[model samples]
Target: MLDGLIISIDAMGGDDAPDVVIKGLEYFLKTTGKQRKARFLLHGDQAAINTLLAKAPLTKARSEIRHSDSSIEMDAKPSQALRRGKGSSMWNAIQSVKSGEAEIVVSAGNTGALMAMSMMILKRKQGVQRPALAASWPNEGGTSVVLDVGANVDADAGQLTEFAVLGEAFYRALYKTDRPRVSLLNVGTEDQKGNAVIKAAHERLSESQLGLNYIGYVEGSDISLGGAEVIVTDGFTGNIALKTAEGTAKLVGRYMKDALQGSWWSKFTAFLNMRALLALKKRIDPSGFNGAVFLGLNGVVIKSHGGTDAKGYANAVNIAIGLAESDFLQTIDVTLEALHDEDDNIGFIK
Candidate 1:
C-alpha cells in the first residue's frame, strides 16, 4: 500500500546476468499473485534485459530500464571497482537510490564491490563509522538478527555498541518485536570470556538506560538455541560464526542423506519420514534467507546472495519491498535518536 515505492535492481551484477534476474521478477509476481503498487527500475544492458524481459510480463509492465554497458567483475577488488565504477550496472543501480528515484536498492553481486559502491554513493548515516551487514538467523523459536557479518574486519567498543543499536532497529522493524533481548556473541556465556572490545560493549549495553532488554552474553552454540533475539559481534567473528553454522547445517543434512540411503531398511524408514524430512529442509533452507541488509546506510540497500536462483532472489526482493513499505529507515532514525538522547551519547546516530 505504499504510495510510490520503486525498487532499483542491478540486473547485470549476478552470476546469471539478466536471465535469473528476470526470472526472479516473474517468480515474485507468480508467488505473490497480487497486483502491487510498487514499481521496478532495472540498470543493465538494455538489449540484454529486453531479451529476458520478454518472458516476464509482470516485470516488463511495471518497470523501466537504465542502460549500462558494463558490470563489475565478481572477483574485482573494491579499489578497481570504484575507479571504474561509472557506467556499470551496479553503480547506476545505486545511483537510482541516491537520486531518490528508488526507495530501495537490491543487488545480487560481489559483496565487497557492492558495499564499496553503496558506501561511496549513499554514504553512512550520521555518527556511524562503518555500516554493518545485518542478516536473519533461523533461531529455534523464530528468527533473530546478527550484525557486523563481514562489513568490517574488526570493530572497537563504540563501533560494536553502534552495531548493536543498528541491529536492534533492524530486528524491531522487520520482526516487530518489542524490547528484543540483546546479547553479545562471545566464546562463552560468562562476562569475562570475550576480548576487551566485546567486554567493553557488554558493559555499555548492560549499564545503559536505553530501554533495551540487554541480556548479556551468548555462545555460538546458543545462537540457534534461542539465546537472544539480537546478537551483536564484530565483523570478523560474526562472519566466521555464520559460515560455520551454515557449513554445519549442510554437514548434518549430508549425513542424514547418507544414513538414509545406506541400507534397504534405512531407505524404507527414510521413505516413511520423507515428509518430515522435507519439512525440516524447508524450515532451515538458506535460499529463503538470501538478503543481507546494509545497516547504518543513509538509504535502504540489500545484498542478495551472488549464487541465488530465482526463488531465492524473489525473497530478497520481497524483503526490500517490505522494508520500504514499513519505512524501516524512519524507524532506525527515530530509534537511534531516542537512544542517543537517553544514553548520553552511548548510542551513535547523532
Candidate 2:
C-alpha cells in the first residue's frame, strides 16, 4: 500500500537484542496476516540472527538481514558513537534510510545514540531548525502529544514555536483533528507567569495565523488530565513532565493494587469490578503507547525504551507500520511547509 515500505530495524539495539526483536517481528507478521504489506531489513550480527531464527519458526524470506559487526552500547557517548561506530547496528540502520533502502527506521535503542545518528544521517527537514521527539501518552480524555521530550534540552521561543507547529501537524495527520489545540507547558496558566522564552512563544502563537488553536498556557496537572491535545515546550521542561507523568502513573497503579488487596472486602469489590478495573488498566497502560516518534526528521524514526521486551518490541514494530501506512512523514512535511510559508508572510507584514 505504501509502495513497499522498508523498515530498517536495529536488531541488536534494545535490551533483548536479536532474540526478542526477531520474535516481535515474527509475531507481527503472524498477527497482521496480509492486512499490511512491508519489508524489514534487520541489521545485526548475521550469525546471531541466523541462530535466533533457527530456534524460531521465522524464515528469511519475508525480511532481509544486514550484517553489522559492532553495536553502540547504551552507555557510549552519542557523539562518539556517531563518529566512530560507523558500522554499528544503529548507524547502519540510519544509513539504510538515507540510502533509499528503507522508508522508515525503528529501534529500541539508546535515546541519545538514536537522536545523534538521526540528526547526523537523516538530518532535519528543510526549514526545521532542530528535530523534536514527539511521544503520545494516554491522558484522562484519550491521548495527547508532547514534543521536544529530550532532543534539545535548551530551546528558545522560536524553537518552542516550531515544536508547536510540528506537533500540530502531527496531531492533524495522525489523530485527524480538525483544529488541534496546542498549549505551552508552564508552571502557571497565566500568560505572564513563565520566563521570557515562554512569554515570547505565547505572543508569537497568538499573533500568527498558523491554523492551530493555540491555547495560551497549561500547567503540569493538565497533561494527564488532557487539557490540550498537543503540548509544546523546551526539552528540559518536556522531559521532566514526561518522566514525572510516567513515574506518577506507575506509583498510582501500584498503590491502588496494594490498597485493593489489603482487605477481604476490597478483594471482593475488586472481583466484582474486575471488568471495569481491566478497562481502566488498558486505558492507562504505558505499553499501549510505548513508541516515541522523532518528528521533523527526513524519514520516520521511532525510538522505543531500552528495557522493552518481546511484547514491547512488537508494539513498536506495529506502531512503525501504522506510521508508514498513514504516510506520516509526507503529511508532516506538507503541513510544516505551509506553516513556514505563513511565518514568512507574517515576517514580511511586520
Candidate 3:
C-alpha cells in the first residue's frame, strides 16, 4: 500500500463535469480505492463540487477541494486556452503535480488544451526531445501499449526509439509484463517494406543494448490480433489507427445488436448464447482502458475520455493510482539514461 498517495483531478473538465467526476470517485472508493487507500484533490468551482459531493459519501470523505472559478472549454484551442487558462481548474490540477503535492493528475478535458498545459507546467523529462502520448489497445491476448497516438504528427528515427523506451516502461508498470514485445507499426512486416524513417527506427532498436523485446514490425490488422505487446508509430499514423479501430468496434457492435434482434429465430439463437455474448461484450468495452498517459513528462498526467461515463472515469482513476504507486518514472529515467549512454558509446548523434 502507498502512504499518502494523492491524485489531483480537474473536476469540471469533462462533459459531465462535477457530477460524473464525483460519482466516479465514489465508485472507485467502493471498488479499488478500498485496497489502494488513495486520496484526491479536486480542482473546480467549490460550490458546484460541494453539491455533488453531498451524494458521494466516500469521495467526500477522501477529497479536498481547491476552488477555481474557471475551466477550459472542451472545444477551446490549445493556443487560446494556454493564453487564458491561468487559475482554471485544469491549470490548478496540473499545478498540484508540479508543486509535488500530488503524485499524479487526471483530466477529462480537451486533449490539446490539457496537453498544452501539461507541457507548460510539467515539461518533458530530461533527454526527452518530444514527449509521446500513449494509449492501451485491447488485443486477443490482453492490452498492448501504443504510443505517439496524437502528440507529434511525425517523428524521426530517434523520437520513435524514445517512444519505444517510454512505452516499454509504461507497459511494464501497468500490466506487470516483463520485457513486453515492442514492434513498429508499418504497412507490412518485411524488412524492406516501410519508408526510410520506420526502417531506421527498426534498425536502431534491433542493434541497441537497451534490453527491450524488439520484435521488428506489425501490420495494422495485428493491433487487435495480438501481434505485439507494445506498438510504436509516429503520431500521424497512430492517431488514424486508434480512431479507425474505435469506429470499427462501434460498427461491429451495432451490427451484432441488429442481428441479435432481427427475427424470432435470430433472437432465439442469441438467447441460447447469451452468456458467451455477454462475455464478448465485456472483452471489447473501450471504457475498460480509458486512461491515456502522456509519457516522457516530468510528472504523470492521465488523459481520460472527454465524454466518458462514471464507470470509465473510475477506470481512469485506477490507472492514475497504479502509476502513482509504481516506479514508472524511475524506470523511464534509468532506461533513458542507459539509452543515452549506449548512444554515446556508439558515437550515435541525436
Ranking under TM-score, best-scoring first?
3, 1, 2
Once fitted onto the true fold, the runs of candidate 3 whose alpha carbons sit more than 4 angstroms away are: 1-3, 268-273
Q: What does candidate 3's lDDT look like per residue over 124-188, in tens digits? A: 99999989989988998888788889988999998999999999999999999998999999999
Model 1, range 223-321, lDDT digits (tens) per residue?
788889899998999999888988998899889789999999999998999999899888878887779899998898999888889988888898888
Model 1 per-residue lDDT at 308: 88
Question: Arrange candidates by lDDT, highest first: which order?
Answer: 3, 1, 2
Q: Counting only residues 3 or more apart in sequence or on different chains, how many pairs clash (N, Cα, C under 3 Å) in candidate 3? A: 0
- The RMSD of every model to the true structure, in order and in angstroms, is 2.6, 2.7, 1.8
Cα TM-score per model: 0.93, 0.91, 0.97
Q: Report the C-alpha lDDT of model 2 over 165-273, residue by residue, as the tens digit.
A: 8888778767767787899998899766999888888888888776679988988888888999999988888898899999999999999999889899999999999
TM-score result, candidate 2? 0.91
Model number with the top lDDT: 3
| Poorest 10 consecutive residues by lDDT, candidate 2 | 54-63
